[model samples]
Each structure stands twice: as C-alpha cells, then as structure tokens.
Target: MKLYQVRKGQFVFYKNELHKVYSVKPMFRQSVHLYRLKDMEQILTRAADIELYRPKHNDTFIFYGQRYTIDQYKKPEPGDYILITKPAPDLFDHYSLNEIEKVEEVHENSVTTTKDNGVKHHEYVMLVPGKSEASQEIAYYDKELVPEEQRLKDESISYLAEKDVTLQPYVGDIYLDKRNNTKAMVVAVTESEVTFGHGIHVHIAELLDEESFELIYRYSTD
Candidate 1:
C-alpha cells in the first residue's frame, strides 16, 4: 500500500505477520517523501495453518516433517521453532488464500526473566482465542520486554483527578489495568465500583487512585 494510504488502526503485513498500525509519522519535505510506522509489536499468532503435536511417554510425533520420540508429555512454548517438512492437511491444500480467516484478537500477558546480575527482561504471551481448550497454545510472543515507546501511555491519577475522572461507567470507555497490561471496557459501574465486560470489578478508589490503574479515555466504536 502507498504511504498515504496507511492509517492508524489498519492492519499491515509486518515481519511476515499481521501487525496493527498504532501510529504513523509522515515526513513530507518535497512530496510525501517518507514516513515512520509504529505498531503494536505483538499480534495474535495464527494457528490455523500450523500443526501441533503433544507426545505421550515414549510416543512418537511428527513435526513439520520430522519424526521424534518423546519420553513424556511435553508442551511447546511461544518461541520454539518447528521445522515443517510434512505435507499440509487436506483442509489447507484446497482452500484459497483469501478464504482463510485470520485471528484478530490476541490477549497479552507477561513473564519476567532475571539475569544473574539482577537485570530483568520481560516476555509477553499472545493467546489466540476461538480454538478448543486442548488445542489452544501460546500462538505468539514478544521475545523481550517492549520498549517504553511501544507501550500505551497511561494517564496519571493526579491528571485523572484533575480532570474529575469518575467511575461513571459508560459503554465503549477503555480502561487500562497496568498490573496485567490488559484493557477492558466499562460495561457497568455502581457508585462504589466499576465493572468491565470481562466481569472484572474494581473499587472506585482503586480505579481512580491506584497507580496500577489508568483512565486511557472514553471511546465509542459507534
């Protein structure tokens, strides 16, 4: 796509996967010459095209195209690269590329790893929904902690208080839970607490005064 055609919230093929365009910086000294694109680095990893093999004690499994024997039931993590030498399933062979459905929502969670020197790095898990529980895997990952520039900005509690941010829940209002790096919608709110669409509840004070919480903004898809 042309530089001018790209917009925030649009999707683009980045690093061989779908990345949501978070922000776009354009430089036009002469005529729309250059632009910078920043995107949320983690996306829902596509699982529909890949095959997963879990082995029982001493059981053999085929991966990509190689056969390996396992002594115990082992699970795969986000970063393991499997060599695919096997032929694809019939379902994949007959379908056209345009007929394939892509995963859109990827839930993110973090794991912290510390070095011997006490320095720490973070890795993120990208969960793909809609698959069966037994089949669902950590479809994608952020290998290292996201840089601050890639993170979503949080509005300070002091700033929120100054703005009179109240726990007046309204549909489409987005709230960020810094503790989990998750975003939820304000589905309902009472005088004492705010409830999210995921059925999570937080006290008004915690929602407004806690450093782990932030009021990103109120928005409506409609």
Candidate 2:
C-alpha cells in the first residue's frame, strides 16, 4: 500500500493476490515500489486442466483423428507459443488438452477428418490415456501452413515477437534445451562446444544447433 511501509522482499496482498516487493524507487516527488507476484492457483489450475505437448523427432501422433509423423521437429521460440495452433507446415501445432478428455500413446497409425461440409474444418478423437481404444471424439484442425500475413495479423503473436530477446549462445545468454527440457545460462563457449552451470557443477554439451534449440528466457543486462 504505502511506499514508506514497504520493505524490499516483503509480501503484501495486492490486486487479489500476494506479491513480493522487488525494489523501491524515487521518482520526482513520489516513491514507487516494484512487486513480483506468483499465482500458485493459476499455475495449479493450468497443470490440472491443460497440458501442452511438443513433438519429438521421428515421433507420430494422431491429430484430428489422423496420424501425422514428425517430419522435422523444430523447437518453438517463446513467440511461437502464441501461434502454436496456427497452421504450420511439417510442424505439429502444439496440442492443448483439458483434464476431462485424454489422448493415449499411439500403437498404430490412423487418420480421420471432418465429414460434414457445413461444419468448420476441425477434427478430433478422444482416447483413454492408458487404454488404446477411443472413447469419444473431439474437434481439432488438421495441419496447414498459415500465411505470413495472417501470422503478423495476430496481435499477441506480433507483440511477443517485438519484445523477444535474440541472443547468440554466449557466456551469459540463457538457453532452453529441448532434449532435457531444462533451462541454463551459457557460462562458457568454444568453437564447437558449450559449457553451462553456475559455479562448481558445470555440464558440457556439443555446440547447440540453432535449428533445434529455442531461445525463450533471457538474462537482463543492467
């Protein structure tokens, strides 16, 4: 509430949630404080209700009642999250599922599509997460390459791309490794390799292929 009463790192209830005070600043005649907030409820809600799935190399999964093989798996950058469901060639648009319905691992290849001409072009199938047989069907879109113009027209996608940080793997750049599903800062780099870690527990890996790794989070220079 009041700036003078706020202490750095103190927790306060604001905007219907708890926020930790980050820093205090004096601007002209008034003082301001920065707050960091985390919504555990929101995170848990998403975890309990929706899951995002990424395609792996050479993997095949059913979409819209059709089977699609991963022709090439390119890790999506942070900006790509906004447009995951948009049409893209050879890319399994990110899949989102609510907790109610489920998709099981594929044992055999299959393909299915919408039949009614009047219905919107979306395909769907519902399968038990453990069992192989489908219990219900849901609506989803088959893959297609969305036009660049249409992609740019999406305001959220455009906004994130504008704010995205582009960094070459360097000593400080943060890297997201799809293979391990982890994030680490590049602590050192050589002509053909990279080492990442904070202090005494460094891990070395081959120089990252730009085509396979994505830049999601970045370290700020202040």
Give the 10-residue window scoring lowest on summed lDDT in candidate 1: 112-121
Give the per-residue lDDT digits (tens) of candidate 2, residues 1-222. 333343333433333333333333444233323221211111111111222232223433322112323322232221111111222222332222110111212212222111001111122223222112321111111113434553233223223224332423467767665435567677776532356663211212112223224556655676
TM-scores of all candidate predictions against the true structure: 0.24, 0.22
Provide the global lDDT of candidate 2 against the true structure: 0.29
* Alpha-carbon shift of residue 207 in model 1 (angstroms): 1.5
Best by TM-score: 1
Expressed as tens digits, the lDDT of each residue in 115-191 for candidate 1 is 00110111111222123324421111231344443322211333333444444446678878765568878787654
Tell me the TM-score of model 2. 0.22
Kindly report which residue stretches of model 2 are placed more than 4 angstroms away from their true locations once superposed: 1-3, 28-30, 39-196, 200-222
